[model samples]
Target: MKIKQYRTQFIQELSPLYDAYEAESFFYLILEEKHNLRQIDVALNHELIFSESEIWVWNSLLAELKKEVPIQYLMGKTNFYGLDFEVNEDVLIPRPETEELVEWIINENLKAQKFKKLKILDIGTGSGCIAISLAKNIPNARVFALDVSKEALKTAKKNSENNKVDVTFIHQSILEIDDLKNDFDIIVSNPPYVRNLEKKEIKNNVLNYEPHLALFVEDTDALIFYRKIAEIAQKNLTENGQLFFEINQYLGEDMKALLEEMNFKNIELKKDIYGNDRMIFCNVSKTS
Candidate 1:
């Protein structure tokens, strides 16, 4: 079948579930991923037809799309902060808002003079996206990432190798670390911030497919990770060390308050591109 004809069928099949344009775009993305053929390539090389086996493979992918499986998961990779990462059901898809979080950290900490080496820790580093991007962008930073799941860390370790950046991947829950590393100049996390009560607001595609361990917190204890992290940050972060988070948009004030109470000084909350209060920043106290 021609590229155009296959796309038409793909769209027709998916239109009931998704919009026409999204279905068409997803069709093209799948082609690019599976066949290494872009939209223009498909147009110019109409004679470049799929072999019988290739058609079978394409048909299988089409069936998965019909189930609303994420294309990133289907391809087993995603681009985050301009780097390709291996992703699966084991890890969360890195979002653009998380890119904003990376930007905030890079822009906030970049210093020109000595090319100072900074030690940074990323807690709940699902895909190692935060730690890897920081290590890549901040030349002198030594980075470490911790994830509760060994399987997710395996993916993150592969991403670190694929990206040619050095990040120490640790398999441990943040809540389990008792002694402070006490070496990091900065600490950051994009932890579980979604309250379970807000699950109704979640779209079906994400709610059904993405990893829930990376997404949800009990409504009554919405600040559980933040509070625990802040407590640990007090002991681990360098004096005047900066702490950053891509936050639950609804809990900005609460997050700030929690940090301040935990003795994180100079706390500030920032909004994402959508104008939602979705990021929080603070610094370690210099004195009692």
Candidate 2:
């Protein structure tokens, strides 16, 4: 059948699960991945058709999409911070809000007049998106990433290599580590801040498919990772070194209070494009 006709049917079948815009986006993404045809190419070539085998492949993918599998996982890759990353069930798919956090780090460090080599650490570095992006953007940065999952580290290591950035990957749980070992000029984490109670707020694509170990915490101790990372940061951060986090929106005040109790100075809570309290920044106090 003509590819355009199939595209219409694809959207119609998926309409019950996904909005038209999202479904159409998925179609183009698959078209580019499987057929190497851009949207413009499809529009221009009215005679283009899918072979029987191609239709079978598309249909199989459609069934999975209806099951609410993330498109990034379906494609086995995603784009973050202008870099392409390999993704799978093992790693949490990088999100746009995390891009903002990376941009903030890059921008702040870029403004410094002293261009010295800086050591950076990314705790809970799923997919190595934040660490790799920092290494790519901040030329003077030596980046290290740590994660608890061996499977997640495997995906993260491949992504660093694919992105052509040299990031040291550590397969250790931050919660259990006594010390970070090296003093870092910047320390950042987007740890498991989503609490168990917040599961109802999550979409099926995330709640069902994304790795829960990287996405959630007990409702009673939602700040467990944050508190642990901050304690380590206090010991490991260089004087005036910065700390950053992508936090759960509902717990902004809780995060602020945690940082304050840790004696973090110059604390700043920032919102994402959606105006959710999604990021926080602070520095280790000189007295601490």
Candidate 3:
């Protein structure tokens, strides 16, 4: 069968699971990855035909797509912050809101007209997206990333190497770290902020395929990571060091309160492109 016809059948078959646009995009993405055929290539070469094995492989992927596995995981890669990173079930796929978090960190650091070098640590750095993006873009910044799961760290390590960014990947839980080298100019995290009750709010593709360790917090203690990180920020951050978080939209006010109560100065809660409160910024005191 012709590739275009196959793609049309793919969309029709997946229409129950995804919209026409999404299914169409999936068709093209698979075509590109498996056959090196972009949408235009497939369209231009209307006679392009798949071999028996190629057809079998495509059918296998279509079955997985119907199961709602994220396409990034299926392709084992994702583009984020203008860079491509390896992704798998081991790590949560890098997200756009987190890209906004990266933008906030990089742009804020640019505003500092200081003579001192900057150091950054990204807690819960899954896929190394935030840390690698920052390290690649921000010159002369010492970047380190931490994740509790060894499986997640494997993907992050690969991402660091692939992106040619020298990010130190550490296998440790942020909640259990007793001490960290001080004077870090910036600390950022996109930790697990989704509440258990919000499971219904999550898309099927995510809930079914993504790593839960990197997605959920108990509903009663949804801010556990943020609170713990804020406490550590007091001791680990530089004098007036900045802190940033990719936060749960529903808990922005609560995060602000946690930082404020910890005596974090200059606390600012900002919304993402969608006008939902998504990232939080604050600075710790030099002396307290």
Please report, as a residue range, the 10-residue window in candidate 2 with the lowest summed lDDT.
110-119
TM-score, cand. 1: 0.95
Q: What is the lDDT for 71 in model 1?
A: 83
Which pairs of residues collide in model 2?
none
C-alpha TM-score for every candidate: 0.95, 0.98, 0.96
Show where candidate 3 strays beyond 4 Å: 111-114
Per-residue alpha-carbon lDDT of candidate 3 for residues 170-231, written as tens digits (9 for 90 to 100): 89888897678655889999999999999999999999889999999999999999988988
Q: On TM-score, who's better, 2 or 3?
A: 2
Clashes of 2: 0
Ranking by TM-score: 2, 3, 1
Best by TM-score: 2
Candidate 1, 154-256: lDDT as tens digits: 9999999999999988888988776565668889999998998899998777888999999999999998888888888888888888899889998888887
| Evaluation by lDDT, superior candidate among 2 and 3 | 2
Query: Per-residue lDDT for 270 in model 3?
Result: 93
The CA lDDT of each predicted structure is 0.87, 0.94, 0.89
Alpha-carbon RMSD to native, per candidate? 1.6, 0.9, 1.4
